[model samples]
Target: MGKAMFEKEKVCFSFRLIDMGNGSQVIDESIKTPMDALTPELQAEYMEVHEQLAFMKTIQKNNRRETERGRKLVRNPLHRLACFCGLA
Candidate 1:
């Protein structure tokens, strides 16, 4: 599955599954920022959250069969964030 988020004319974020050519797949994430648009503090915070998401993706990838707990834990935070942002 894939998803893309847009802001104005730009794609702010996206992710998709990529075939690695070795009978494996990987999740690829793309995060984009407008030049000089974000304040230093905001940029730092964004990167921190991005790192956390990356770590979570890694965990999910390493565990071939996702446990119910793992699935819920990974999804709940994102669901809450979406709801908080009025997107859910």
Candidate 2:
């Protein structure tokens, strides 16, 4: 990963791997982005953008759940109708 960073992003990042058990491992990574060196105003702006992205993700998740629930609702009647007609 460090080598890839040097080749692609041209930035130095460090990480370590910890073995859990049974061939499982976890990566503890630390990367310095340009945002880390931002000024106060820029940091605030970055945080605002981050918050907006989190909000959007949450909204998308709720929307997906609602859509799946709606699909189930729509299918339930058809399923019942099929069962009534001995087609199920």
Candidate 3:
């Protein structure tokens, strides 16, 4: 017989807070369980999505840093001098 089918009474949304500077992440949001869940496949898929999201966050952080570095390399001496002397 096929695994018993069950419907989730309520859908749950999850969120995470990440500190891109240090590559640290925390799941600050709560997770709700599903109803009449069949095999463990669903759970596995959910975890996979979160993993992908975390990876993307890390990549985004790195990209931002690289872009900033590139901009600094193109800085004008006049601008740098202004900041150094507290005048623009």
Q: Write the per-residue lDDT of candidate 1 for residues 1-88, one digit (tens) a residue.
A: 3354444465332444356979875556663555256677855755665677789889987775567667786579888798789987
Q: Give the TM-scores of the predictions, in the order they appear.
A: 0.36, 0.47, 0.44
Off by over 4 Å in 1: 1-32, 65-88
Compared with the true structure, the alpha-carbon lDDT of candidate 2 equals 0.64
Per-residue lDDT of model 3, residues 1-88, tens digit only? 4344564345443643434667865555564444234246756655676688789999999999999986885497877888789886
Ranking by TM-score: 2, 3, 1
Worst 10 residues of 1 by lDDT: 8-17
What is every candidate's alpha-carbon RMSD to the true fold? 20.1, 15.4, 12.5
Better candidate number, 1 or 2, judged by TM-score: 2
* Each model's lDDT: 0.63, 0.64, 0.64
TM-score of 2: 0.47
- Give the winner by TM-score: 2
RMSD of 1: 20.1
Q: Rank by lDDT, descending?
A: 2, 3, 1
Q: lDDT by residue for model 2 over 1-88, one digit each (tens)?
A: 5666667443322333356988975545563335445677856755665566579889999999999998896689888798789987
Instruction: Give the distance in Å from residue 59's predicted Cα in candidate 1 to where it truly belongs.
Output: 0.2
